[model samples]
Target: MRGRLIGQTVAVMAVGLLAAAIDGCSRRVTPEDFAEGEGATAPAEMSPQQERSSAQPTGAPEKAVTATDPGGNRNHQPGDKEPLEGVTESTPSAIQGGDSSPEPTTRVSRAQRTGGVAERPQGRPVQGEEQAGAVAPQVDQSQGLGDQAVEATPTVAPADAIPIDQPEERPQLAEGAAAADGTDDGRPAGASTAEPFNPLRAGRAGMGPLRSEGAGGEGHPAFRPASTEASHEGGRQSKKYDPIAENGPIFVGWPKPQLALVLTGCQNGYLEPCGCAGLDRMKGGLGRRHTFMSELRNKRSWPVVALDVGGLIKGFGRQAEMKFHTTVSAMQLMQYETIALGANDLRLPAAELLAVAAPVDGKTLFVSGNVALFKFEYGMTARYEVIRAGGRKVGVTAVLGKSFQQKINNPELEIIAPEEALAELVPVLKPQCDLLVLLAHASRDESIALGKAFPEFDVVVTAGGPAEPPLDLAHIDGTSALLVEVGQKGMYAVVLGFYQDEAVRYQRVPLDSRFPYSPDVKLLMVNYQDQLRQVGFEGLGVRPVPHSRREELGAYVGSQKCQSCHEVSYRVWRKSGHARAWRTLVHLDPPRTHDPECVSCHVVGWNPEYYYPYETGFWSEEKTPELVDVGCESCHGPGEAHVKAEMGSDLALQRKLQQAVTLTLEDAKKQQCITCHDGENSPDFKFETYWPKIEHREWEDE
Candidate 1:
């Protein structure tokens, strides 16, 4: 099939070239054609001295003009003057050389032949040449033969004449085709045919070459014309997804309410997006979230009550613990009234969990019904809380589901059934406030079950759902209670409005580029990085483990060692963005050089999948400067043994080492590239497109 396609493509190209050549031969020309335009009249006879005086220095090499067809008859008639010493017929084809045959057929000019403009001389024109609309000298018909008129070419070529070459000029079609202006020739309606057709000249001034959908050249994917739907789909995919626009504004048709409830959670350790892809493509950062909240409280002047359904950090480690603290601090700055714990939050040690949940200025920081730290109720967390907003008492409580309960392995933690906990708190909490809210950190079904079981609650904010939550509210099967999932990754927020007589209004707000970075949260990020730097790798619990195949394969030797034998591959890597990954981190707003989560991907020796360092992996810039930035061993196995075996006289060992280090394109697509270009960071990553940017296929072996 491929061979047939190649053959068809070549045949099509050949046909196009033939068509273009035939089009160039259609326009005929003769010596009398020069005097055919308007206002052309033959000049009166002049003496030899007057003719010499009227001639201008064109500076071009003088050549003896001759008839285009050498075999054509040149019989002298009665009134005909003899041909001038060095001049011949003034035909368009004669100015530019034509065919040597006797046939009267039109010949393509030298400019068209070379696909470029002919070199014309440059000098000042003789006086009287400046007159506008001055016509070319004409031949006298009364002479019975013809009057040979000597015409001087102008210094400045006219607009309708041959154009100067442009680097980005679009290709022009041959004469007789529908021109750039939709005429027979590419000119105005009443324009003269004085300028001979030059197919090499641009179809129009400032026009660039045509661009096709997949016209990218070498090192890019083969051309594949996209359908209209495919083109629209590609445009949509290229930009950040906007759920808000797709699902309309929540409060657009509703009147301003007395109270607005802002719900957010399931951050999964993302205080902000990685932003490595591009800020325009990034969404759901704490910086943008704060800005969104600030607009509600300050800009729109609405009374707001912010709450969270937490899954605060994704992983359990010293880094996560610190990140939890930073996230909590940022949320507190945003004035969140209450926060509920999710499964990941329960993975922390009992002491650390208590510390993070600790009250600020005698106010509760975290509220949960089923989870208990140290197997007992603590002041740090509450079973339920009633807060005042817009002169109404609003009750809030949280419960961890049985499914999430199974994931926690903390010995000091006590987990109870969500039904048992909620059954105990609902009756007491319902009457205490005008509106009861439940923060259910569970799956969608479990959340719905809780909402159905306790319809007394006005709203149930759930944890599990799509990355960008649906704008339309999900109601309990048989109650007025609304079930809401605020999505994951802190990318969006659900705002619920409370009115005296109107229906409760809901809005899903995506924390997109429209929101500016909040200075308060930005400073917290800076301080968070500072904390990471002070803690160092060990303090953050980063202990490098030995490579899984260390004994069989090898230990990592920096990319510099590979340069000795693979200079071409080394140069390719040096020019790729991977080589400057570490520098990119250094140039980040807060400089995440010290942040383990970011540094793990940017530097070598670190495990990109687990976000940690290997036994011989990069530790610090000063300690392992050679390992800075992603390098050869990032994809290939460690190179120490391979380098040694190749340098030594052990042929069998060298073969074994080389085989271990060799990475197939299939393996890279499935395992290697994805380690760093995962969905959260490089969302637009495609192996086909990305591979070409860093491809180094200089190896001899297949």
Candidate 2:
């Protein structure tokens, strides 16, 4: 019975196979039948490549692709060519499964795959069908027939069905999601993985490394522009005749006057010019200012009434405190009668301010009408002071504006509004003096309003205005009060000369090189430098901070180490002015080696922008002799990593080090050079002219 059953099963199987073979032979198989999503299998005799080619969806055209060679040249394959507009070329790793080995592969653009039509739903109609209002066919996705679902969808290819050859062409994935290639690394799709470009890097093609702008990295101490009239060559004084000498006498046509009111303020802690570029280029300094005042009193033999509408220092710290004291002492030596405190001045500790304002030789020098310490008026400051000038009583009062009052955060300080303070005081003080002056540490508009509101003030010396004040005095509309603005950084002074019969002449004087440096002020500067040296950098409130690129670039190794491999470039730098920067400071009448402001620009390891030292920056000649002067590291960044890389046998590391130090000429012009050659220091600095002087390279033929 078992043998009969087996024979019957074998006969049934043979008949079924024979019947299927006959049915298949009745019809011929076509490429359309093997189209993707149709569920039709390829013929047994077809090769894998041919099978893939036939697997393409029906109606999709074959596209020609460009293959990249090892030399980066491209070769085109034979097919219908499609324009590759808007397609970014992918790396070999992106297309070839983490294998960067040079191998030719077809490159297909997103546009080519979609037949010049933007991707849409798989079965959705094109623009032509949409215009005709053709309805989309529905797909039964629940049936789990992938081919049927694909066939029912419209124009857009299924997102997951991107061809293996075009991985980069895949649609953008959600941010932080893995890409089709599985190397997204959490970055947004298509984001670059290379390091950001730094223009300041050294040895860069087309541009050389950075060069220090001034002797000491600090540049000019004052915030004034260089004089256009004067020009210097080869570090010498201008051969051209001095403009101030040829321009005839100052205050050109003003008649002889009884009293000269010399106005100066907004010193901003510039005791003297750095004089790095040349004295002729610099405009204002305390030394030059004193000479101007001295000439008014002794040379012209005119009675002088010196005053300052204050903004004494720029920054706050121990350095600022010292600068404040030095400025006040210098003002006293110039015989300034009154100094009005500005917002910047009020930032100082209240106790320190009171001490500075205290009377010297039984005479108060600082005055403010609205400010109070601990909510009560104290110290040497008074609401108003009457002074005898030009044989007439002059009433002077100062008020801090309401706008500036908001900037102060000290709980111990109390500030009354400028208008309110002036209102109460003006009524009482106006009758006592023949000339009334208001020192308004306020905005220009507020000053004008005060002048217009009270009309009793004869002159208003305002703090805010253009850096260069107008030649003529401004009068408040509908009021006789004159508005006087002495420009910022103490670059210019507005002198009001009062003569018999109330005749007042206005002269705006630029404290240029025409005025000689005052010996008295020079002594003060020497003393100030001495004080800074004793206090040291740390004592002056400056501490070393880590370099921004410390880990990658490493610590500075000076220019000498760089000299071994770069002899030609080193020789060029040796002869350049930067190498002799330290000598310039030492040769000055009063040596500035001890001065942090001067030393920062002249030496290595200091950040020129902040005027502070880096972790391994120059401190003193004895401690950091090798790091002295503006060395190679100033521009190229620290060289420890670069040096190690170059000395090693690794060719790849050497190439990377070379690239790391490279700087571009455009970057040097826009970023690196400006740090030192700013308006105040290198006023006559034009990159086109200056660059040629220090231009150097390893290969002269290039």
Candidate 3:
């Protein structure tokens, strides 16, 4: 009882101190104030290649703030009652069997806005409180941060009197439940524990992996998150619980000032819309995204912060270079605050990756916290960046997936686990910003694990892994952390709505026909194509040979050659989408003809690196017109031998040609369609549904 009273006295003293600290704040700390500090030293000037090879990894810890947890040793074990709100206890010199006075325990509250922190619980909603969306009072992004600061109110309790409540059980939706809105309690629809990952249906039902932090036994200091709902300064409900119904206006009568966080992932070098799906059906692209964001800010009056969760480009090849440049340029126009570096980005030689990371007009900062230039000491990116948007300090950090790290393979680079990186990072960053966000380019399971262990993150945006339905708003189990992943191929951009005193609402905005193409982006795409042409990938189209498959295939004998003998099939090819594939490239904003990346898919019988080994196979469009536009040999075995056989009188030769023709058609539906109509190029592609569109029967035609 005496110990308890002592703890109470200490708590009261700490609260009084906290109140005094807040009272002295002269001005709001802006992002600009924190932006100019230290980061990984840019590699010294040298050949780009040498810069990558010579740079040593270094760890530069942020200036240390006194550690907040009391006693320095608060390990929790299994079976311990975890507090809903985390408890921080600082010991006084006297409590340690010393002569100094007892230290007070301080409870820090979670940030509720994109970058707004409250000294006291300003807009926190209690359990079962009904809140509705309201327009937040607007503030310019550049200034006026101090006026919006919420005065902190210290909630005092005896250090030892912390509540011992079991963590709240996360509610789960029924199997196959409609994922239209959030759950009964207004949390994102909790995914079923049993649902397997399905990327194609992102923004729907899915569950990431869950890992325990091994906080053990009784008295585990499990930090409970602040209430999810926002509360006004007066501690009253701000709005009623009235969600915009499905099919309702996306932004009709938003209550007050709100922050819209727009996220995209797994672009994979797809800069243009795939014509296979019409405007109505076509889902994504930088153009549509630009249009959507512009309208939201201009039409809805919502302050928006945009981020890309990585997987920006498909590869590091020449073609991807063009796409990369174009994509980055588009992101700049869209005003992306940050782009997390994904495994695909790392595939580029380290030097090239760094080149990509160089600030684009000082608008986007590419980051990956877990990837080190070498050891765990120093790493890629500035570790964390705080950017101001919506008049708040938004802190962003990144963690590249381990799978990508393994692929990097360079001895000079080291990739650490996300949890390990966050262990050292979050504490330092948490004190610096109002709201914290993580760009986690990892598997769904890994991202979830990160969230569970680190509840300080306000939002965890993830990418990579198979394309699943976009489940943009999710709460990590046992914590209030929100995890969202936008599916691959730029099909949809997930929008997370944040109101001052309401639960964050999430929706996937399909970037389809409704949004017009951004003219600036369109012009940018055209300029990229022109740049490609200037580099000599012109008329013949720069198609690289797939050196790995060289041993198994025969090639060449252009499409025209096949047409001489198989007129009906040639005509059919001309009429099919395959025939116009090249034209699609040609018609794109500025028309890209020589891009090795774009060429590989539009033309037949080659990859981006090398040609299959065949005496008369396609070498160039001028040299092999018959091999152009996804001709007969693209799916059939390369026609060099087959053509020779057809022209020969040998009985064996004739029989072989016939056999080849029959087998080619038989294999068409299986290997032929899927090879090109893949997830990245044609997400909606289904052979059964698509085959009939181009099916041409020789007999029927005759």
In the range 1-702, model 1's lDDT, one tens digit per residue, is 999999999999999988877776654443224322101121221211111112223333322111111112222222323321111111111112222222221212222112222221110111121111222233222111011123322111112332223212211221232322232221212222111111112120110111111111211111111112111112244223432222212222222345679999999999987755555445688988888787666534456889898898998889889889999889988888778998989898878877767655555668888877765444446777767766566778899988999998888877789999888877666544567789999976688778878877767888876666542343444444566778788988877765432234455666665566789999999999999999998888888999887887677779999998989889878877778788778777888888888888887788876788888889998999999888898888688888888889998897777788889889999988888888777766688877776777644663
**Alpha-carbon local distance difference test for all models:** 0.60, 0.58, 0.50
Give one digit per residue, the lDDT tens place, for model 3 in 435-554: 678898887667777777787776778774334333223445555456676777887777765433323445555455445678888888778777767776533244344433343334
Root-mean-square deviation (CA) per prediction: 32.4, 36.3, 24.7
Give the C-alpha miss distance for residue 260 in model 3, angstroms.
Answer: 2.0
True lDDT of residue 497, candidate 3: 52
Model 3 TM-score (2 dp): 0.60
Model 2 Cα shift for residue 252 (angstroms): 2.0
Candidate 1 TM-score, true structure as reference: 0.64
- Which lDDT value does model 3 have at 624? 63
Task: Say which candidate scores most in lDDT.
Answer: 1
Which regions of candidate 1 deviate over 4 angstroms?
1-254, 375-380, 411-414
Candidate 3 regions exceeding 4 Å error are 1-256, 276-279, 359-364, 372-380, 411-414, 464-472, 537-555, 562-581, 607-616, 664-666, 678-702
Candidate 3 displacement at residue 493 in angstroms: 1.6
lDDT tens digits, residue span 514-628, model 2:
6777899888888888888889887988888898878888888889999899987888677667787777677776777777777777888888766788888788889889888
